[model samples]
Target: METLATTEIEEDVDRISHLPDFIIHNILSRIGLWDWIRGGKEHHSQLLRLSVLSKKWFNLTASFPYLIFRIDHFHNVSRLNFFKYVEYATSRFCHHHNHVTAHTFKLSTTLREPAELDIVIKCVELVLNKGVRVLSIDILSVLGVQRYRLPNILSTVSMLESLAINGCYLPSSFMVNALQFKSLIRLKLQYISIDDEVIKYLNTSCPLLQDLEIRRCNGFKIVCVTGHQNLQNVTIAHNTQVERIHIEAPNLSELWLDERRTMQMNLVSCKKLRKVTYFGDLLPNSNSGFLSNFPFVDTLMLDTKCNNLKLSSHSLRTLVLLSNYDLEDIEFRTPNLASMYSRKYLFTMQPSVVSDSTHLKASMHCNPYGYIDATWFQKLRQFLDKKNGLEVLNLHIRTTCSLEKRDLEKLKAIELPPYELEHVQLQLDTQEESSAHRNFVDAVFWCCRPRSLILKSSSPLIDFEEQSDIVKFTHEKLLEQEDQSRTKIQIVPSSSCEAQIHLSDLKSLSKALPSAEQIIKFIKEEA
Candidate 1:
């Protein structure tokens, strides 16, 4: 019987191996082995293991068309051995698919010696010769090591569509000609030092370019992106040395700027802009409303320090407010807004919404240092008011101290208006004693009446025994109010399905409940 079963499994494997090349490739791609955006060392190893099944599988893996090599993947091997492995692997692939046009090739490693750098350049040239369209080379820089200089041979590849270079230095002569990047559509440069002239060259050279990103790069003071009618998305973030940015892309739709320092921005012609993310002090200093420049923007994310900020936009749909420490008041006049997320240190106030939309989902993350008082609950009630018609509310409360009995009394003394939500989730991170857990639950219930309360731990380091005690206390408290409120408690266990059981059933399955780490893992997976 064992021999018969083994023969059947081998026969099934043989049948799958005889499939057409396109069918096999499609099957492998479904596992994310050939995806440029998904594959990693694990996927590569899985592909190699699959190749050992048969010669047809080996050939298919060699001609996979998407290749990625990273030295960090081989941490147990020496640097020289890693390079030799790369050379041997690439040589085998190139030999098998001599005339095939590779779709993408990515190499990420650190080079301490000049010979290693030369070998990397050679590998890049070899990929280009194979007509690889998408090339990404991320050379990590050591503290005292010289930065890698981008070889000029890349400029000769007119068929390249997407190119990404990190931790490299681009000389002035590189990409100087306008005819170099004729087919390039996407370009990303990070941790690079390139002059302003090279940027100007790309601005005029790559007419078909649609996406451009320059992050944490230096040696360029002013960025003037103009005359690219096809450009749609532009991101310039964390480049503190950039003093001025002037963009005139008529077809541009998305722009993201995350600079710590103040800078001048001219986006007068970006009328088609639909989303804008600004993270700096540029908003408070602007003479006019910064959002007025892009009237068509539907999504906006702001991380700045402003006291009384007012946003009035007709096309706004989504808003994300992050790290606004000095924010006191916010007035929104977005009639079409549908979703809003506010993540900050503390919540002293909520945005005053003057919209006609009845459907809105709001999520908030509040990190309080010492303790949560009644005033915080009052502000939270104002934020989650019934007038907003919020469909769901996800609240993450992370506090360093526990709630006292007096705080709980004060919270209960303040009568909050009745507002029932469709779904309410509370992620708690506190160091309160097991006795104070009941007071914390009472304070939370006083703020809002949630039909279903989803409870989970916010911090992974929380003691499992203590967290289990908290959960048990919360279950008992909710059961005491079950007759009056009919609220159901949803406890998300780590390895099992979400059990929405009553406190009366705790004795029957108390040992089966998840630990703190399991709850955190489940929360992350859900997120």
Candidate 2:
């Protein structure tokens, strides 16, 4: 009995041995805030029970300021509990006032009634008082509901550096006259209705702002973004402004715009603008704006119906265009745009885009629906093939091509040179999760693993995973058929940077399959 007691006491003492403060802190920091709060009420609580294990854990978990309290569409949380939970969870930041580096409040679309919305406003008010640096709000639930003007609660957070607001309607006061945040460095505003108020605020405030995006805003009435000394990159989308924009940003290196029909811009300056996305056609009436502006850009994206683009003095080397313009008639200096690609939807009528240079690449999306004019498509392909241009051609394997492998063969056989085609595409259809479907996707992408390519998928996550597994499995089968030592194959996840590199052809993949097979096998072994 004495021996047993002595052993038990020693074990207990050993279990309570000191853990380094840093290690303890690391464990507490990893605990989710909501998990900690909810665990306090449950029988088999994970977080609350952990707090009692050590005094150090309790303090650190309680003090961690960077909290992510997401109240989105799916969760086991009640409305009242969620509201109370937020108030309690943010109390540390609201009352005690710590420097909250990042505070995210993601609301759900289930807030059907006005009372629920009011509760949200109050909650937002509390968090703003925390002086957060990053505030991101996505309120797509406010789609059809009548928009109530947001109170000046956001103006109080003066230390804010990055603000991302989407799908929320803003009142004129916050946009035009508000001088609340002076330290804002990066601002991304999308799908938010705009008026004169917001335009004035953007021009006056955010003097030190470096990155700005104004996209798909319905109520956008004005464009006042002019001479900013510190602005570097700007992406403006779907603006219905009256007309006429004069830009003179010396440090502004990149500019993108998908403006409305009435849009007009006189780039009296943007001399250092290396990257440019010209969207709509420069209107005939706006000849004054066009004649006065001169662009000395390195990279250009023609993403509109603007076929009459005239490049006078551009050192442009890379270009990405929308489907509609012809490249045959275009003039080129020392520029080589054959390194770029185009993004378009399927079954859409696309004109053959023109480029004087042949170093183009197809890093953009092919139409997912379908393409109407195969002749135009053939012309572009032949042009690329003739120049030995474009390292990759990213296509929509399913939706973009209405034909099967036989039909594609007919198209490929049409009197073209032996330019090794490096075709890249994605099977984003959910049905591709099956073995046969996965083979189809694999067949499309495996046609070539060019030196560089970026293929994106639109399939849902589960379908994407299933399709990925099938593609990988098919690659394994192909490796077995080919000589293992001669082929070099690299199976990279779609998320990796290496996923961007596509090669010459399916035959080449068979040749390179050995190396890629070895890589895949090694990765699985390490796992």
- Report the number of the highest-TM-score candidate: 1
Give the distance in Å from residue 436's predicted Cα in candidate 2 to where it truly belongs: 29
| TM-score of candidate 2 to 2 decimals | 0.56
Screening candidate 1 with a backbone cut-off below 3 angstroms (N, C-alpha, C), the clashing residue pairs are none
Cα lDDT tens digits for candidate 2, 164-251:
7776766445754666667888888777777766767776777788888887776655566776888888888775553655566778
- TM-score of each model, paired residue for residue: 0.63, 0.56
Each model's backbone clash number:
0, 47
Instruction: In model 1, state the lDDT of residue 165.
Output: 88
Model 2: per-residue Cα lDDT at residue 155? 61
